[model samples]
Target: MTRSEPDVRAEQEALFSTGAEHYARHRPGLPAVLFEALPAGYGRPLTAIEEARLVIDAALDAVSGIAYGVAHNDPELAERGRRTLARLRAERRAPLSPTGDAT
Candidate 1:
């Protein structure tokens, strides 16, 4: 005997129904290192530092959920994120020397 499509959908729905709140509360967010990137750039509106932090936190948490899924090899969504991160590492730019040409 084979399960009907509705039966499969029902089972999947039940699995997440109980833990929705836990999922929302325990999620991770942006790394603190990213805050340096948010400084004012000429005419941009000044967002209150507190409000800006909340937004950044929410964004980080959301993306971390995505990255966690991707990192663990969830093929269903594994192809959906940044293609470069797995292969490429980031390099910080070196500061220019106080003296003349850095060359």
Candidate 2:
């Protein structure tokens, strides 16, 4: 079943709030200079993972928009969402170069 927009938004807001609260409660008090001293590779994998996650999130958001548009009888919004999904799918199928750009 498609979820209502408000329901989905509330869930996202709650999740973000929880994450913020956790960080606030447990994050270290280390100075910025200490973080800067760490090796470059220390956070490279994390950065890559986060970048991948953002791409996935964009796809999911398009899907959610399609669902919401359909539920609300907004054909224009639904079509736009469909186009976004199609473009994303094409990008996914394209051959990637060594540097990760589609070629």
Candidate 3:
């Protein structure tokens, strides 16, 4: 059965709360290949794997920034968090171009 939005979010929050410390400590650094493969913009439809990777990267970036901001008391990290989150939201809302491209 499908889970409701609140259920999904609650589960995710529980998972993060339990693992945030370990995640902060042991999270692998982003591979250069991942960055290299990113398009300059969403000008074409991404493959399923590419889309998943992008989502994960954006989530991680935002979360990591928040953690860093808390640890270091740096406001710039919060700005980065905001930008990354906005990018993710835009990606979700963006419609395909006339040619069925992502842009």
Candidate 4:
């Protein structure tokens, strides 16, 4: 039988609450290699639309990380998520030229 929305939500919440501690304890943190791989800009220049698309993709990734962090009470993950989100917001506000330079 299908469950109602509220019922599904309540069950999900219960599962998350019960599993959060285990998840926080067992989950591995982000690798140092990942931080090292982040660069100041793309290797090659991109158009304004390309830059915008990159920002949107990064924002979606950050949001997913934030949601997982919150659900599992992972402070380090949450902090990284916040930093990624802030960077994305700044990128979104700044205008990009056709050559991907800040305008």
Candidate 5:
């Protein structure tokens, strides 16, 4: 932020780290319908297993334990979130069922 700029500049730009797994961990889970209802640009929907794998990867990535009580908090979960997002993209075009449903 430039010193001359007003304080209400919305911090220049809102941040969106690709690995924000806070939603996957601290936050309550999202609904199945929400994933199925992903916007048209999500590429394709995924099967139950594919979705589960994505979530599992995110959960694992959020673990940032330390030998003592002095560790960086929030689990540094970006990598896992990235993997999950990638999986979601890959699964978008895959048939979700034998009937050829993508979700």
Candidate 6:
């Protein structure tokens, strides 16, 4: 049987609250070697579009961590991920570009 909207959302929220807590806690940092591989603009401030891209990347990572945590039978990871998303939303009030979009 098909689940109702609230049911699905509830399930999702539950999973988010539980899964990924461990993973988020011990998440590893990118190695310096990887940064050295990039062409340029490594240390400079990000441009508008670039900053937007960073935000998108962070969101994607947080979501993945949450999902992964859920799949692995962890829950707090999801809550951590949700907090990250909330923070990102709060910090991203300004437009990313002159057109007010990443594009």
Q: Which candidate comes out best when scored by lDDT?
A: 6
Q: Cα-based RMSD of the predictions, in order?
A: 19.4, 13.2, 10.8, 13.1, 13.1, 12.0
Off by over 4 Å in 4: 1-43, 94-103
Quote the lDDT for 49 in model 5.
Answer: 51
Q: Higher-lDDT candidate among 1 and 3?
A: 3
Rank candidates, TM-score, best first.
6, 4, 3, 2, 5, 1
CA-RMSD of model 6: 12.0
- Give stretches of model 3 more than 4 Å off: 1-46, 93-103
lDDT tens per residue, model 4, 1-103: 1244532332333233223433445665744343233221224444455545556655665677679989999876766667767765664567667676667
RMSD of 4: 13.1
Residue range 3-100, candidate 2, lDDT tens digits: 54532333333233333433444575634453333223233432333344444665676677689989999885576567667766776744445665
Q: Residue by residue across 1-103, what tens digits does model 6's lDDT show?
A: 1244532332332343223333345654634443333323234444555555556666776798789878987786676777778877888656555774754
Q: lDDT of each model, Cα atoms only?
A: 0.35, 0.50, 0.52, 0.52, 0.38, 0.54
Query: Which candidate should be chosen as best, given TM-score against the real structure?
Result: 6
Which digits, one per residue and each the tens of the lDDT, describe model 5 over residues 33-97? Answer: 43333322245554455544444443343332221213434334444444545654565544456
TM for every model, in the order presented, reads 0.26, 0.42, 0.43, 0.45, 0.27, 0.50
Give per-residue lDDT, candidate 2, residue 32: 44
Query: How close to the true structure is residue 11 of candidate 6, measured as C-alpha lDDT?
Result: 35
Q: What is the lDDT for 17 in model 5?
A: 18
Between prediction 4 and prediction 6, the one with superior lDDT is 6
- Candidate 5 has a TM-score of 0.27
Residue 54's lDDT within candidate 1 is 32
Which consecutive 10 residues in model 2 have the weakest lDDT in total?
Answer: 6-15
